[model samples]
Target: MTTVAYQGEPASNSSTVARTLYPAGSELPFTSFEQALDAVTLGAADVAVIPVDNSAAGRVADVHHLLPESGLFIVAEYFLPIRFDLMAVSGASLDRLECVRSHVHALGQCRKVLREGGWRTLVSDDTAGAAREVAELGDPRHAALAPPAAAELFGLRVLRSAVEDDPDNTTRFVVLSRAAVPAPHTGEPTMTSLFFCVRNIPSALYKALGGFASSAVNLTKIESYQVGAGLNASRFYAEIEGHPEEPRVELALQELRFFSTEVRVLGVYPAHGHRRTERSG
Candidate 1:
């Protein structure tokens, strides 16, 4: 079976996506996103599933900063509906719980329940990891906010289901592999991810992005961050609806190159179905 690496414990959301994408693959959990990506880069795993953003919690990881240098290609994307449950040791009553533990984002998402229960919050590295910790501690005074599936995985009892404030919470993940797959030139809705650094010249960014507007290329996402110690040297990660080799996309990129010090295509893959759902709504 192929091995899939993901950050967080066995039942974390990334692992959930890995299972959905590669059901037959073995899962290897890592303490951090860097470690999981490294596993793919070092040939220890076939692919890595990483959470990039969440609708409720905003950006989950700084993938914009990591992907440009990871030497990995985005092979696919997955959207996982996030659901957090309050779980505790079997036979542990809700009244006995003093504090709840989960990843910071999970805790934030479940604030309503935590506030209603008057439970203190503790931050763990991951949601499922918090469940594991709660199980190992075997404390009636402690509970965890994680996926309901985690209750079975970690031998806990779910005290409350779907505790998140938003019923429509969802997370976007990307599958990374050592080498790029040939994204089809046609037949499926495609998305291309790229990183570009604007030239020092004034309005370089405005000039670089103007072509997309003129070409009617839809930019799905764009994010900017400073590179190392160079405060003025900012790099932008962008996702566009067209492939790099397509005529209009090519023309837009040519203009980008003229105004950018560097322009690198990170991936060109099929857009996830969830994107269509989001757009329709």
Candidate 2:
């Protein structure tokens, strides 16, 4: 059976994704993203399911910084609709709650409910961890904001269900493996993720990205960050909506490489179904 690793307790959002993708697989949880990725690298787990970004909270894990350094490749992507539940000990009353606890992202996502309750906020490493703490504390006055499944996992009662501020909040997760498994170029919708560092010259970035526009290749996302302890050295992480093997995409990448000091193709995976749904909607 596949051993899936993720950075959260059972029933946390990451666990939910793991179960959805590999129902028969055993799950291994770690305290941090790095630890989970390390498990996959060291052959302790087949792959790691990690959250990259959320609609409501923006970036969850800095995958741009972590992926290249970890030497892992993205094998697949999943979109999880986020829902937070306010939960506590069995006898907890919503009106009598004095404090709320959750991961910082959960707290930020459920601001509407937190604002109405006027409760003190405490941050935990994971939303499920917060619920576990509430159950262990046996304190009716302290409630946790966590995934709906977390209440059942930790034997806590749900004070409120679906408390997220945005009804359509969703998180994007990536499956990482130690080896590259580039999807076959079969004309299906695909996403190519890569990292590149442009040569430090005038208009280097602008010139580097011009290839995509000229080739009519659609770039879905791109972001730059400083590298090598120098303000002048900038590296970029980008996602484009085509397989690298395609003629236009290949041409664009060639042009990109011509102007870049370094270029690495991180992954080329089939695009998640949610991307199509989102674009059509």
Candidate 3:
């Protein structure tokens, strides 16, 4: 059975998505995204499922900065609906709870419930990990904000369910493998992920991206961050809605390369059906 690596304790949203993608696979949880990616790179796991963005909380900070250097390929994508529950030990009461703990993102996303309760906020590594800690501590004064599944896994009682700020809260996860497995050059929908660094010339970015507009290639996502400590150089991570082998995409990439000092294709994989559903909705 394939061993899937995820950045959280069992029952975390990442783990939930991993199971969805690899139903019969064993799960290996890591404390952080880097460690999870390391597991796949080191051959300890078949793939690492990492969350890139959340609808309510925005981008997962760890993933955006780590992916370019991870030396892993985006093999697939999965969308998991995010839900947080207020949980505590079996007999713990909401009135008696003094402190609430969870991942920073969860705490931020569920600010409404936390603000209403007036509990001291504590940040933990991840949501499920916080729940496990609460269960192990067995303190009536302590509660956790995590997924409902986490309450069941950790033997905690749900004090409140669906406490996230938005009902449409969802997280986008990407499965990474050590080797490149580009999507077939066929008629099906696909996405291409790449990293590039443009030159320090004036209007370089505008020139580089002009081809996409000319070619009618849709650029779905683009993020730019400084490389190392260099203020003059910046690297970008982009995702476009076409396979790299396609004629239009190829021409666009050719134009992009003319203005870029470096360009690396990270992956070309099937776009998750969730994107289509989300767009239609």
Q: What is the model-wide C-alpha lDDT for candidate 3?
A: 0.91
lDDT of 1: 0.92
Point out where model 1 deviates above 4 Å.
none
Which has the better lDDT: candidate 2, or candidate 3? 2
Q: How many backbone clashes does candidate 3 have?
A: 0
Worst 10 residues of 3 by lDDT: 61-70
Candidate 3 lDDT, 1-281, residue by residue in tens: 99999989888998899888889999999997888988998999999998998898889955557888888899898888889999999889989999999999999999999989999999999999999999999999999999989998999999999999999898888899999999899889999999999988999999999989999999999998886676776788999999888899999999999999999998899998988998899
* Model 2 clash number: 0
Reference-based lDDT, each prediction: 0.92, 0.93, 0.91
How far residue 134's Cα lies from its native spot in candidate 2, in Å, is 0.3
Over 4 Å off, model 2: none
Model 1: residue 9 alpha-carbon error in angstroms: 0.9
| Winning model by TM-score | 2
TM-score of each: 0.97, 0.98, 0.96
Rank candidates by lDDT, best first.
Answer: 2, 1, 3
Model 3: how far residue 117 lies from native, Å: 0.9
Please write out the lDDT profile of model 1 over residues 1-281, one tens digit for every residue: 98999999888888888888999999999999999999999999999999999998899889998899999989899888999999999889888889999999999898899999999999999999999999999999999999988999999998999999999999999999999895988857898999999998888889999999999999989999997675586889999998887889899999999999899888989999998998999
The positional error of residue 241 in candidate 1, measured at the CA in angstroms, is: 1.1
